[model samples]
Target: MRLNNSKKAKFFYFLSSLILMTLFLGAAFFVLEQYRFYILGWKSVLLIIIPALLALIFIFSGRQIFEYDSDGEALNFRNRNVLTFFNKPVRDEFPKYKLLQYEFVNILIFKRLYITISSKKNNLIILKYDVSYLTGKELKDLKFSLSKVIKANQEREKNS
Candidate 1:
């Protein structure tokens, strides 16, 4: 199974851009008014601050784009931010037999996936991915796929 949240990421970017543009325009208007009246009022400050805060929240929450692929013998995962210039993308690939455990964590509006795998040197490596924008169905599917792999690994271990 291969899954990517390109659509959701695009929509999120669009909404964030809209909010940011609104914040900038509102700030500009406030600045113009302030220049004319020389009056600093609480309401005006809030009018600018509220939208700016909202924009920041939206940008931070929707930064990551998640992708999962499990077609071959190895499982592949990619996590990249919407702002490509800021940070490097994270990519992980390990054979199915290397998977040790998987976990999902939900904190308020954020959702994360954690996977532990065994390295060639017999060390454990943990990888984390942001899955906040994935729909309920998509999340369920991903969980099911990972669970199948873990089960297979357990059975193989028992036989060995």
Candidate 2:
């Protein structure tokens, strides 16, 4: 199974752009009005501050685009932010047998995936991914795929 949330990411970018534009335009208009009327009241400040805060919340709540590929004997995962300059993209790949456990977490606007895997040095490594942009169906599919791999790994371990 291969899954990527490119469509959702595009929509997110569009919405964020609209909000940011609105914020900028509001601030510009407020400044112009203040200059014309010489008014420095709380109401005018509130008008600008509210939208700025909302835009900040909307943008900060946003998550990176996530991609998953479970082909051949390895599972590959990738996470890249919309603003590429902020941080480097994360990529991970490991064989099925190395998978130990997987979990999903949902808290308000934040959704995340946690995966535990065995390293070559026999140490356990935990990885986290933002899944806020994934749809319900996509999340379900991801859970099913990870569960299948975990089950298979458990069976193989028992047999061994």
Candidate 3:
């Protein structure tokens, strides 16, 4: 199964970048004009450059969403970064039957679904959206499918 973002969701990301860019440019102008004499230090340049680059990247790169695919043996997680720090792709094989599961819990105090992969030890992927919008049957079906994955992994480990 695949999950794709709706049109509204895509548009919201674009709208957010526009707002942030406006605020960032306003601050940049203030620093360059009003406080240039006092804050002419290297620290000022460092701060401004970092945020400006971040804003530019966000404006250019639309929001990235994660979806799972089961064709290949390994789990794939992809994201872009400011620096190419982790250039090598992760190729280690996790337990064969591990499944991604989500629990509607307070993930670090926020009301988001805590998504994790369950094996002998739980490998947390990340906090996803809340379960408030999901129907009862949808939630049940999702949980059931995920449990099967966990069960398969456990069996594989036992045989090994």
TM-score of each candidate?
0.88, 0.86, 0.37
Over all chains combined, what TM-score does candidate 3 have? 0.37
Model 1 misplacement above 4 A: 37-40
lDDT of each: 0.83, 0.83, 0.47
**Tens-digit lDDT string for candidate 2 (73-106):** 9999998777665467789998999999988888
The positional error of residue 75 in candidate 3, measured at the CA in angstroms, is 2.6
- The candidate maximizing TM-score is 1
Count of backbone clashes, every candidate in sequence = 0, 0, 0
Error of 3 at 57 (Å): 18
Better of 1 and 2 by TM-score: 1
lDDT per residue for candidate 1 within 1-160, as digits (tens), equals: 9989876667766776788788998898788767776566656676688888886676556446889999989999998877676467888887999999999998877788989999999999998888887889999999999999999999999999
Better of 1 and 3 by lDDT: 1
